[model samples]
Target: MADIFDKKPIAAFGEMAETGARPYYRTAAPDAIMAGCNDYLGLATDPRVVEAAAAALARHGTSCSGSRILNGTLPLHEELEAALADFLGCEAALVTTTGFQANLAVGALLGPGDASFSDMANHASLVDGVLLGQGSRHRYRHGDLDHLERLLAAADPDAGKLVITDGLFSMEGDLCPLPGLRELADRYGARLVVDGAHDIGLLGACGRGVAEHFGAMDAVDLFTGTFSKCFGSLGGLLAGPAGIVEYLRYTARPVLFSAAMSPASAAAALASLEIIRTEPARRERVFDHAERLHNGLRALGFSTGPSVTPVVPVHVGHAVPCLRMWQALHDAGVYTNAVVAPAVPRGRALIRVTPQATHTEEQITRILDAFAACGRRLGLVPERAEHDWTPVALARPKLTP
Candidate 1:
């Protein structure tokens, strides 16, 4: 009872606000380098993306003011869906008001007679969606193909089956086993669904996403993605065969009940998608930057758990230390996300660092320098003999509030 009463609320680190689309952002410390945003290509601040939204707002006003089933369907909506279908190499696609809703719509298609095999590390939206379906939910260990295979083999042969996984695991910064999951789906007569929230505009040679990266584009039964991450907009998209997509348009409750996406959002996503396809250099830069950051962190004696993508998690092991590290880094003019219990398991707290294509080399260097200083001060890493430990931080974060 004493422990419970004395427990304090976890430190709130959600104070950073973007002044523009660049690497530096306005926070309590004035200006700090943004290394934690999900905007992989930095398209959120691109002039083209901004102009598209402005143009859309001028042309279509503000809100759709109704669900797509009623009067909400606009020309931009259809155009974006068509463009998404072409980009993703699907027969058809449907746009949702939110990525969370997209997953809910897909998973709600399953019921008592259906079964869903999910990865243990899949996004909460996918997990909750499957639960809402009221189906037999079989959770396999994270990225364990052998365990997934066994689960699939043991399920009822005649019951409808679905396999759900995130294209990229958000916490671990690892990708899903697409080829393995595809093979398992073929063997077990299950439809494979992917939540490509972090994959679209980043994965594959042509930026088609995980299926394209794995050469299983045609094998996937459903591909769901979000505009918030890659496109720097707001909304979700689900791409599949015409029959399935058409059925979802008619039957998905989220689509029927929810207000349609704002016109500016649809336009911005469409514009961003075009730029993502045309600008190959942006994608290449992001990959190279991710590699540099990953190697730099490991060399500084920080453990990045299985990260080969832009999303990098530096393992801190304990919740308190993790919070301290985040604060230290914040004071040194670098912003990062502090992951703790409820988001991850106890003793697995971490600092998540994500790099953007638009981040300059100088910004990256500054970030590394700050991390080195903070890590050494916190005893999180060894002190380098070559460098003096002068603090670069202007102010430390306020943890009480």
Candidate 2:
């Protein structure tokens, strides 16, 4: 808990929680038509994933009770890592307690003396990782390869450089230009790191991720992802060449100090990976749902970003109206997230909604219907719920009290 003494506020600060207005929580379905959370492939509720976790609980009790590098290392952990490496087509893979640690480990240990380059809109975990690392870094414009090239060209040629970006922007649902970034990285003598946190089971031809989406297999140098989204698991992974992974497994602070993940989560990860590899139809369904929302919103005259993925954000210009729009949607029995100032810049608040593979066609249609109705009532859509201008966010969300 935070100290009450820290609650000192200036005249500009306003009451959000006290006003009894905020639209964000992780609860079970109130009814069946709910659509907000981003389990894009919707594997979290799969029978196979649930059963695997349950079986692990029965055999291993509840927790591992130690760190993996210490007494917490179990046979199940090794088995899961081996399976993940094969599935991701990486030489080796290291499983961490959560997605946050997975990225942190790499950033802290990988570039001790090298220079780093990151997209301005990369995940917070990735930013934190870079800050904790031994190298200096330059943040390029969001998904702008030209800006990245300019930064790369101006950097020291003798020093090592690594470029990083999110394969899919979580809030905007737009894809990064991987192929173009790869070309720039190679021409400038830099290694590329791609965060596939959202793209793993949602993008790519067979869900192999963005490397496959843009056919940049030869260009990517490092890769990281989470099991919670598509794997229906609750941990993170760092996959790459064998030697680098071994170094992280032994030296990363989060891995060395934190207790290991439970066997239940490990089992769930294994089951989820298997399902993702075997089921291509799940990804297809996710894309189909996204396309429907994109078309429907545009037809209603709502301004959306250039997104080609499952995440769709309906732009709302101010914070107060954004909150009202979120509340109206909730009253209509649909839930979504409200992003306001600082999370987004001033005058660019938005109501971000996501559609998943498990969401039926009727569910998608209902969400669009709610948007049209609530938007009209709120006047967010002057011509029918549409606004212009892109906000500088999609991920790296700050805590909202």
lDDT (Cα, tens digit) per residue for candidate 1, span 1-401: 26657865443332222111122243534578988989989999999999999999999999999999899999999999999999888999999999988998886679788998999888888888887786688999999999999999999999899999999888878888888888899999999999999988887777877777776688689999899998999999999999999998998887779999999999999999999888867877887777777778777888787766888899999777787888788878899887877688878989999889999999899988998899999999888644322211111111121
Worst 10 residues of 1 by lDDT: 392-401
**TM-score of candidate 2 versus the correct structure, residues matched by position:** 0.90
Query: Tens digit of lDDT per residue, candidate 2, span 224-258?
Result: 88887777778888888898889888889977888
Off by over 4 Å in 2: 1-20, 25-29, 110-112, 382-401
Question: Ten consecutive residues with minimal summed lDDT in candidate 2?
Answer: 392-401
- What Cα-based lDDT does every candidate model obtain? 0.84, 0.77
TM-score (all chains, Cα) for each model: 0.89, 0.90
